[model samples]
Target: MLWYVLVAIVAILVGVVIGFFIARRYMMNYLKQNPPINEQMLRTMMMQMGQKPSQKKINQMMAQMNKQMK
Candidate 1:
């Protein structure tokens, strides 16, 4: 009976680890295929805020955003 209980606990732990990895991979892939933001969206947002966004500034912002994600 003790052996059976130990095996059940081990199985449950392994399953949880595997599930975590699988879910993480899925989300990473999804994010890569569909990023949370794009240059056009960023430009629109800056315009709405009454700021004239230059290409260099936009690129800098994008770099900062990507760095934050990592």
Candidate 2:
């Protein structure tokens, strides 16, 4: 009986760890394929805020955002 209980606990822990990694990897891939935001979206947001987003400025902001993500 003690052996069974121990085995069950070990299985549960291993499952939890594996599930966590699988979910994390799935989300990372999903986000990479469909990023939370993009250049066009950023440009629109800036324009809505009454800021004229030049291409250079947009590139800079995008680079900064990517840097922060890393």
Candidate 3:
């Protein structure tokens, strides 16, 4: 009766929490293995924008990007 309903609600809550954590972990690993951006892509983008890309600039951009992601 009421006990069965309580169990069902708890089970649903637990499942939701577990699913959220698992999905979060998977996404974190995926991002680490394959970052959203790379030096080549950044260079290409800068060139397209009419800015000559330099190594120093690239490194700075990468640092900023990583900081934001973290």
Clashes of each: 0, 0, 0
Q: Between prediction 2 and prediction 3, which has the larger lDDT? A: 3
C-alpha root-mean-square deviation, candidate 1: 1.2
Taking all chains together, the TM-score of candidate 1 against the true structure is: 0.87
Clashing pairs in 1: none
**Per the 3 Å backbone cut-off, how many clashing residue pairs does candidate 1 have?**
0
Lowest lDDT sum, 10 consecutive residues, model 1, at 61-70
Error of 1 at 7 (Å): 0.6
In model 2, how large is the Cα lDDT of residue 34? 83
lDDT of 2: 0.93
TM-score per prediction, in order, is: 0.87, 0.91, 0.94
| Tens-digit lDDT track of model 2 for 2-66 | 99999999999999999999999999888778878899999999999999999999999989887
Report, for every candidate in turn, its global Cα lDDT versus the true structure: 0.94, 0.93, 0.96
- Number of the candidate with higher lDDT, 1 or 2: 1
